[model samples]
Target: MIITHDLTKRYGRTVAVDSVELEVREGDRYGLLGPNGSGKTTLVRMLLGLVFATRGEIEVLGQPVPKRIQDVLPSIGALVEGPGAYPHLSGRVNLTLFDAAGAGGRRKDRRQRVGDALERVGLAGIDRRPVRNYSLGMRQRLGLAGALLRQPKLLILDEPTNGLDPRGIREIRDLLDELNREGTTVFLSSHLLAEIDAFCTRVGVMDRGRLVLQEDLSSLRAPTGRVTVGSPTPERVVALLDGRVEHRDGEVLTVRHDDPGALNAELVAAGVTVTAIATERRTLEQVVLDATTTSSDRVEAAG
Candidate 1:
C-alpha cells in the first residue's frame, strides 16, 4: 500500500531522511520504529505530501506522491503528529465540522460514521463534551475517530500510543488489529516496542536518518534461548562449553545458543549439577536496541 525508493529530504545541508526505502503491503500492520530525530516523522510527512522530498520517489496506494497526492490522499487517513481538534468545539462538532469542511461524507452518513468511529475508539458517550475537557488519551482517540471517518484504505499513525493508559493502549491495538484483519493497511510509528511486538507483523528500524533494518517480526524473533545455570563452581560449566559462555553473574553462568538440549546434556556430562536452569528470550526492545546501536556504530565507522 506504500512504497518508497531512496526517499530523501534535506533542509539546506541537514538531511532529514537519507535515501530511505520502505514498502508496506496491503493488510499489513507495519511498525516504523526509531528514536527521536531518527527521520521517522520526516518520512511520514513526505509520504503525506506535507513536506516535499529533495530526491527519490514515494508512492502511496499506487499513486506517486506530491504529483498525485490530492488524488491519493483522499484514500488515506493520517494523524501525523496528533489531532487538530478545536479546543472550544465539542468532540462531535469537531468531527462534524471537519466532515463538512473537507467534504468528507454526506451529512447523515457523516453523523453515523462519526458516531461509529467515536464508539470504536471508545469515545461515544463523551461526544458532546468539548475537546478541552478531554484527557490526552481522549484527544488521541478523537484524532483516530476523525481519521477513520473517511474509511480510508490506509491509515498512517505516528506515536499513536502516546499518552494512552494501558487500557486505552489495548483498546487501540485491538481496533487496529480488527482493521487490518478486515483488509485495511495500517502504518504505525511509535517508540513503544512492546505494543509493536504485540500487533505489528513486520518492523523497520531506523537510526541516523536511515532505515537500518526491516524484517518480518516472526523471523526476527526466531526462538533462541538463554540458559543461566547456578552452581558453586561456574567455571567448570563455562569450561565445559568450550569458551561459549557469555558471562558469569556471581554463581550463575549465562550461555546463549539456539540449542538448549545440547547445552543441558553438556552440563550434565561435565558433572556440574545445575541448581537453577532458567531460560531467557530476547524481547522486542532488546532486538531494537541492538539493531539501532549496531547501525549507529556502522554509521560512525563509515564517517
Candidate 2:
C-alpha cells in the first residue's frame, strides 16, 4: 500500500532521511524499527506528506504523495508523535468535534461513529469527565479511538503503546491483529523490538538515516543448525551424540543438529531420557543488533 524510491530529506546540511526505499504491501502488518535520532519519524512524516522530501518519489495507496495526497488520505488513519485532544472537553465531545472537522463522513452517523471508536479503544461507557482528568494511558486510548473513528483501510502509527500497562499493550495488540485479519494494512514505527517481534509480519530496520534491513519476521527468525536438549542422563546424551554436542551445562545440552524431532527420537531410542528438545533460532534482538549500530542518542567524547 506504500512505496518509496530513494526518498530523502535534508535540513540545510543535516540529512534526516537518506535514500530510503520502503515497501509496505497491502494487508501487511509492517513494523519500522529504529533508535532515537535514526529519522524514523521524519520518514513517516514524509510518507504522509506532512514533511516534504528533498528528492526521490513517494506513492501511498497508488497516489503520488503531496501531489495527490488528498485523494488517498481519507482512507488512512494515523497516530503520529502522540495524539492531540482538547483537554477541557470530555473524551466523547472531543471525538465528536474531530469527526465533524474531518472530510466526508455523514453528519447523521457521527454519533454512532464516535461511540464505536470509544468502544474499540476500551473506553466504552466512559463518563463525561473532561480529558484533563484522564490518566496518560486513558489519553493514549482516546487518541487511538480518534484514529479508528473512520474504520480506515491503512493505519500508520508511531509509538502506539507508549503510556499503557502490559494489559493495555496486549489489548491494543489484539485490536491491531483483528484489524489486520479484517484486511487493514498496518504500518507502525516503534523502538520496542519485542513488540514488533510479537505483532508484525514484516520488519524494517533503520540506522544513521538509512534503511538498513527489511524482511519477513518469519524468515529473519529462521532456525540455527542447532538444538537445545534437556535430559536427565546428560552423560549418555553426550556420549551418544559425541562430536555433535557442542556445549553442555548440567542437564542442558546444545547440540549441532538440524532437526530437533529426529534428535529427540534418536535419544529416546538409545535409552537416553530426554526431558525436552527444541531447535534454536536466531532471536529478533540479535538480528536487529547485527543490522544496526549503537543508538544515535549515545555520544562518546574523543580520547
Candidate 3:
C-alpha cells in the first residue's frame, strides 16, 4: 500500500532521514521499529505528506504523495504522534466537528459514523464529559476512533499504544488485528519490540536516520539448527546427547538437534525427565540488535 525510494529529509546540514527504501504491501501489518531520534516520525510524516521529503519519491495507495496526496488521503486513516481534540468539547462533539471538516462521508450519516467509531474504540457509552477530563488512555482511544471514522483502506499509526495499560494495549492490538483481517493495511511505528513481534506480520528497523533492515517477521525469526531442551537433570541430558550438546545452564541445554520431537522421544525413552523441548529460533530482539547500532539518543565521550 506504500512505497518509497531513496527517500530523504534534511534540516540544513543535518539529515533526519537518510537514503531509505521502504515497502509496505496491501493487507500487511507492517511495523516500523526505531529508537528516539531515529527519524521514524519524520518518515511517517513524509508518507502522509505532512512533511515533504528533501529528495526521492513516495507513493501511497497507488498515488504519488504530496502531488496527488489529496486524492489518496481520504482513503487513509492515520494517528500520528497522538490524537488531538478541542479540550473543552465532549468526545462526541469533537468527532462531529472533525468529521464535518474532513473530506468524503455524507453529512447526514455523521452522527451514526461518530457513534460507530466511538463504539469501535471502546467509548460507546462515554459520558458527555469534556475531553480535558479524559485520561491519557481515553485520549489515545479517542484518537484511534478518529482514524476509524472514515473506515479508510489503510492505517498509518505512530506510537499508537502510548499511555495505554496492558489491557488497553491488548484491546488496541485485537482491534487492529480485526481490522487487518478485514483487509485494512496497517503501518505502525513504535519502539516496542514485543508489540511489533506480537502483532506485525512484517517489520522495518531504522537506526541513525537510515533504513537498516526490513523483512517478514516470520523469515527474520526462522529456526536455527538447534533445539533448546529443558530438563530437571541437565547432566543426564548432556551425557545422553554426548557430542551434540553445545551449552548447558542449570536445567536447560542447548543441543545441536534438528528435530525437537525426535529429541523429546529420545530423552523420554532414556528415562530423562524432559521439562521442555523446542526448536531454537532467532528472536525479533536478536535480529534487531544485530542489524542496528546503538540508540541514536546515546552519546559517548571521545575515546
Candidate 4:
C-alpha cells in the first residue's frame, strides 16, 4: 500500500536520503533497519508529507504524498520519534482530545474508540493517570493507542520498541502480528535487529542515506548449518578442505557448508580422528549482520 520511486531528500547540500526506491505490498509487514543517522526518520517523514523530498515520487494508500497528503493521511496512523503526549493530561483525556481532533467517529463513538484503544494497548485501568506519571513503556503504549484512534489502514511506526521492557516488547510484537493478520499493513522502522527479526516479514537495510539491501526475512534467514569437529589436529582437518573451514576455536574446528555428508566424508578421509561432531543453524541476527557487512563492503568498493 506504499510505494516510492527514486525518493531523494536533502537538507541544503547534505543528502539525507538518496534515490530510495521502496514498495510495501498490501498486508505486508515491512521493517526498515538502519543505524543512527542513517536517514530512516527522514525517509519516513517524506512519506508522511511532514518533509518534502528533493526529488522523486511517493505514494501512500494509492495517493501521491504532499499533493494529496491530507486526503490520504486519514487512512494512515503513525508514531514517529516518540509518542506525542501532554504530560499534564491524564491518558484518557489525552486520547479523548485526539479523538476530537481526528475525523473518525461521533463524540460518544470516539469515547468508545478511545476506551477500546486503551484496552488494546493494555492501559484500560490506568487511563485516568497523568501521562507524566506513566513509565516509558506505558507512554509508548499510549502513543500506539493514539495512532489506533484513527483506525488506520496502514500503520507506520518508528522505533516503537525504543523504551519498552521485554514484556512490553512482546506485547507490542504480538499486537502488530495480530494487526497484520487482520490485514493492516505495518511499516516499521527499528534499530533492534531482534525485534525486526521477530516481527517483520520483509526488511530493507539502509546505510549512509542509501538503501543497501532489501529482502524477505524468510529468504534472508534460510538455514545454513555449521558443523564443529573436535580433533587432535584441527589445522590439518581444515587443510583437507579447500577453504570451507571457517575457524579453529580451542580444540574444535568450526566449518560451514550446506552439505553435511560431504563434510563428514572429507573429515574422515583426512584421518583427523574426530572426537565430537555438532551442527548449528544461523540465527536471524547473524544473517542480518552478514548481509549488512556484505552490503557495506560492496558500497565501499563501488565508491
The list of candidate 3 runs beyond 4 A from truth reads none
Candidate with top lDDT is 3
Give one digit per residue, the lDDT tens place, for model 2 in 35-117: 98899999999989999999999999999998999898889888889888888999999999989988328999998899888
Better of 3 and 4 by lDDT: 3
Q: In model 2, how large is the Cα lDDT of residue 22?
A: 97
Give me the runs in candidate 2 sitting further than 4 Å from their true place: none
TM-score computed on alpha carbons, candidate 3? 0.95
Segments in model 4 whose C-alpha atoms lie over 4 Å from true places: 222-245, 250-253, 261-303
The predicted structure with the larger TM-score, 1 or 2, is 2
**lDDT by residue for model 4 (77-194), tens:** 8999889889999999998888788745677687789989999999999998999999988988999998888788899999998888999899999998998898799999987888
* CA lDDT for candidate 1: 0.85
lDDT winner, 1 or 2: 2
* lDDT winner, 2 or 3: 3
TM-score of each: 0.85, 0.95, 0.95, 0.83
The whole-model lDDT of each prediction reads 0.85, 0.91, 0.93, 0.85
Please provide, for model 1 over 34-98, each residue's C-alpha lDDT reduced to its tens digit, 9 standing for 90 to 100: 88788899999999999999999999989999899989876787887888889999999998888
- Lowest lDDT sum, 10 consecutive residues, model 1, at 294-303
TM-score (C-alpha, index-matched) for candidate 4: 0.83
Which ranges of candidate 1 are over 4 A from the true structure? 223-244, 248-253, 265-282, 293-303
